[model samples]
Target: MARYKNALTKYYVGDLEEKEANLRLAKWIQAVEDDTDEEVEEEAYYDGDGTPEEDVISVKKKYSFEGFYDNDDPAHRFIADLEFEVGEDRKIWFKQERTSGEILEGPATVTEPKVTGGEASEYQHFSFAIAWDRKPDISKSDDDAGGGVEG
Candidate 1:
């Protein structure tokens, strides 16, 4: 059996290859929750009672993580550049391999980034947030991750 650790997770910004990513120093990858919810309305009729109606209202999702600080890393640069994007047109992504050899990945938008360091503290990290519309997909490999994408 393979041991699991934060280092096993990989984060990629945009379409960049993993070689240029900084996930090697990852300390933690927090779970993201899709805020999408369903709306239900119940109306009383003058005659017999009726079943309540329901509707789904999709909402923005959120993803967060903490990793070693590396200003030169492309993922870090991509996250920093997101602050300057007025319309937030860019996308961020992440992938993690499970013991079963399955990979999880999806599209995301960076929402926040926090850098923390102190005197006598050699370990520093950059924690960031992202918005997602859909939950990531789990595949056997990167090439199979397109299950979430449609041609």
Candidate 2:
């Protein structure tokens, strides 16, 4: 088995069309979390076993990110500006690159960053949530095109 370090993961934000050229790295990030949820419905039949069956009707994928605040970073700036955009159409492209070289890209709606905590000596930190507009695209890295491998 192969092991990968979380420190090597990269995150970016920008327009999807010019993703390669325009994407800005989310710098000084401390943590990235997956916040996916599912909605299910239960169905019970009159002439069947006593156990009820549950089916997943829908799924919602999201990410919760936490990091030190940096005013100079374009990605951070973009997230901060989202606070002012109140409409449902407010969305931006995001990409995640795993250490194993798999890429996850999509458009997502971001909530305004909220201050996680503050202290007299500690650096200011913030956290925000990102909800995917739809299912994201996942692709394997060029190096892994031929075979399946776990990182």
Candidate 3:
């Protein structure tokens, strides 16, 4: 079960690599190194109710992948990073990256994007579950000058 930390992790800033975005996270952000190859530690700010406030605007996560193209590419582009958008309100997209070339062969296609600017990417990711929200009662707030019998 994924924990909705009420805010984005300091590990992400729009779409930036961990190294490129660490500075952007600032003190409010939190991060840690994991013994495993996979990223282990991540931090996010919180509001009074354990939710991200206006000061916290991002709802995204960035993941990285680096391995040989294995397929055939001689240079063997590195799968730099994968970015994931927080929340399930919309479709999530991952940006593909290559450490050596602007475009590299992926699986059977060569359409994946490469690392550029500071745009973190998402080649792999999962969406946040959307839960039902409670409805508000506004009948009393409605202004009804006319009675049940209207001309």
Instruction: Assess each prediction's global lDDT (C-alpha) against the native.
Output: 0.52, 0.73, 0.23
Residue clash pairs of candidate 2: none
| RMSD to native, candidate 1 | 7.9
CA shift at 124, candidate 3, in angstroms?
21
The lDDT of model 2 is: 0.73
A best-first ranking of the candidates according to their TM-score comes to 2, 1, 3
* Per-model C-alpha RMSD: 7.9, 3.6, 21.7
Question: How high is the lDDT of residue 115 in model 1?
Answer: 58
* lDDT tens per residue, model 1, 84-121: 55443555565545434576566655666655565565
Alpha-carbon error at 87 in model 3, in Å? 21
**Minimal lDDT window, size 10, model 2:** 16-25
What stretches of model 1 exceed 4 Å from their correct place?
1-3, 16-61, 115-125, 142-151
Residues 121-145, model 3: lDDT tens digits: 6222212111112111112213223
